[model samples]
Target: MNHSLDGQVAIVTGAARGIGLGIARKLKADGARVAIWDLDVAGCDAQRLGFEADHLQPVDVASYESVERAFGATVEALGRVDILVNNAGINGPVVPSWEYPVDAWQRVLAVDLNSVFYCCRVAIPHMRARGGGRIVNVASIAGKEGVQYISAYSAAKAGVIAFTKSAAKELARDNVLINCVAPAMVETELFREMSDQHIEASKAKIPMGRFLQVDEVGSMVSWIASPACSFTTGFTFDLTGGRATY
Candidate 1:
């Protein structure tokens, strides 16, 4: 059987670059019209993502008002939303829990965890009104295995995982399937935020002896956000390169 996303409208947060941009490319290639939401819309090339200028918008997912307006604009311009990729996130201060700054910790949770709830809260009503939709949260293997020196990032992602499962149950009968994609390590701009020691250690932990690619993660997300993904919700898909034991 073939999976086609013809006529679908998707919103990919943090899509100005990295994994989010990669996902937008794949989704557009797969026949879905995509909208990018981020703080600065500078890096996004509508031509590169095969979208029009109107599809890109500046949005701070951490702010409820920003999310609501951006989502409303998307529906107004694209017609209706069929998929949402919650990929906006940040890797806060890399320090032991005792040494992590309070502000950094709070910001990480606000962006990485609470933003998911905010985006979902605004998007779910639109989705349910449309009868169905798909939501794929971009979590991390750290959320599951808990990496050292990045306690805030690890905890926020774990919250995302838990929130996904709980939200799935709440929306089970509504036809809006929600799930998570937990990738171990990927080569992207996000790497610049990590220390050399941390990056090398992460790569060493993956049994495949290499980091995952952005396009590979994109492919997983595209499918999960398609009708082909029906019947599975609240599930966590791993892109860990053989490091996941469960």
Candidate 2:
């Protein structure tokens, strides 16, 4: 499928590496000018990565102030914001719910859930000014079917799913579409934060018998962020390899 985002400008959070980077690469490949937003901006090689030097934004999406600053910078540099990918997140410690530390739980929700709200709050006005836009929030199957050990991650993602739906409805009349992707386990650096047993268990649940690839996520997100995805607002598109039947 040729999902062309020609002449558009996209802001992808946490895009310095892993799945966020994958989404940024695909958006760039599909003809969108991408602004890479991440805390590790110093680690990115703009020339090597094919992103413009001016568009590399060091942003902490969990903070509204930081998100606001980044949004203004992106608009000043890129001219407009057509797509917003709330992809920055952290997989908190993989301990059981009761054993989950209080601070760790709060941190997970701050990054995974609150960051989505913060980014959307900052970008929606700009997108409205631009006439219309697409927003793709990266959620997870854990949100739908709660994961045993990662309660915080699961809860945060569930919040993302709900938030996407509500935001989509509010923007439907304004042509500002919002949707979310509920992907299963993707083999990223996040796996380093999980236990070996949890990893195997997650993989075993996938009918595809494999973890999701980053490019696969990019491909789906590219379509969702494109004009072709019209008529699909407030939806949770599943990328769970059949692990989630709904």
Candidate 3:
């Protein structure tokens, strides 16, 4: 697939590193002008140097106002945004749903789920103005299968999938397509943060006996964001390295 994303302007959140950075890099390589958004300004700068993309912005995806401001500035600087990738996320402490801290649960929901709302709420208008656009959300296998120890993260990601579906249906009428990619045990900084035992257990359960690569996920995201993905709105593409069979 040529998947020529050339001349498109995009915003990718949590893009300082990991899968988010991978998506940004792939989009840029496909010829999109990408703005990398991250909470860590220093990390964003370092990643920017590494990729040498079009732009970077420090954004708090959980705050609607902050998202609005950052996105506003991004559009003003980049001219317009045709693609939005909501990839900012955090996995709260691993514990049973009944025992998880209330604050931690709320925080996880805020970042993983609510941030999607914040970004879309702001970006939708821009898409409207542009006549059409694409939004590719970064969901997870936990969203579909409901991971045992990470109930809050699972629930929040599940919410993202639902939101993507709803938004896709609503926006498709206006030419904006929304979709999500759910990956399992991707080898990224976030995956490396897991406990050694958990990592071993995760590897053992995968049929591939290994984690998916970031660039692999990036390829799927790039396609979803491209004009080539027409006619498929509000769908979840599985990138789980065969672990997400249902």
CA error at residue 75 for candidate 3, angstroms: 0.7
The Cα error of candidate 1 at residue 70, in Å, is 0.6
Tell me which residue pairs clash in candidate 1.
Answer: none
Report the C-alpha lDDT of model 1 over 136-221, residue by residue, as the tens digit: 99999999999999999999999999999999999999999999999998999888898999999999999999999999998999
| CA lDDT of every candidate | 0.92, 0.91, 0.89
Weakest 10 consecutive residues, lDDT, candidate 3?
41-50
Question: What ranking of all candidate models by lDDT puts the best one first?
Answer: 1, 2, 3
Judged by whole-model lDDT over C-alpha atoms, candidate 1 comes out at 0.92
lDDT of each residue in 52-162, candidate 3, tens digit only: 767878888888889999998998889999999999999888887899999999999999999999999999988988899999999998899998888999999999999
TM-score (all chains, Cα) for each model: 0.97, 0.97, 0.95
- Candidate 2 C-alpha lDDT tens digits along 1-246: 437899999999999888999999999988998999998798688675656533899988888999999899889988889999999999988888999999999999999999999999988998898789999999999999989989999999999999999999899989899999999989899889888999999999999999999999999999999999988999999998998988
Question: Whose TM-score is higher: candidate 2's or candidate 3's?
Answer: 2
lDDT of 3 at 246: 61
TM-score winner between 1 and 3, please give it: 1
List candidate 1 stretches off by more than 4 Å: 47-54
